[model samples]
Target: MAQVANLFDIIHLNKKLADKHIAAEVHLRDACGRQTLWFELKDVEEDTLSRAQDVAISYFAGKGKPIEFDIAKGINFWIKQF
Candidate 1:
């Protein structure tokens, strides 16, 4: 798992997840006076998405807030300034 240093890497990961039938959403934001990024998975089974989420979480964990994911729904991610 390489560090996501730019938008391209983010987009690439999203496509990869989608290719695997996983719905992933990536959001970028600068809010709350802090800079942070997060990834969420929705509209998927917990079992199917868990592995992906684990990898993602491991990559971005502790960067800010804990990553939030809902496999039963869809996948979404966001960045915030807090």
Candidate 2:
């Protein structure tokens, strides 16, 4: 079974990215000390959220990392594996 080693919330982000959109990076660590990166998009309209989710899901799925996201609140995240 897979296991999560760490969950990193985005406490800081690039100013350019933030100014462009509600986007940030979230990092995850796995049992073997491997790190995976994911993107977070907050306070988005429905259409934008949908597009972002689709792109994120596809990208992260290729990297073999599952995503945990909460749109209502700020981008606080957790890590889990199967």
Q: Tens digit of lDDT per residue, candidate 1, span 3-65?
A: 233666467656766766766555555455443344565765657556566555654555443
Worst 10 residues of 2 by lDDT: 5-14
User: Stretches of candidate 1 above 4 Å error?
Assistant: 1-4, 30-35, 54-82
Clash number for every model?
A: 14, 0
Give residue 27's error in model 2 in angstroms: 9.2
Runs off by more than 4 Å, candidate 2: 1-45, 71-79
**Cα RMSD for candidate 2?**
7.1
- Candidate 1 worst ten-residue window by lDDT: 73-82
Each model's RMSD to truth, in Å? 6.7, 7.1
Maximum-TM-score candidate = 1
Measured with C-alpha atoms, the lDDT of residue 78 in candidate 2 is: 35
Compute the lDDT of residue 40 as modeled in candidate 2. 57
TM-score of each: 0.44, 0.37
Candidate that scores best on lDDT: 1
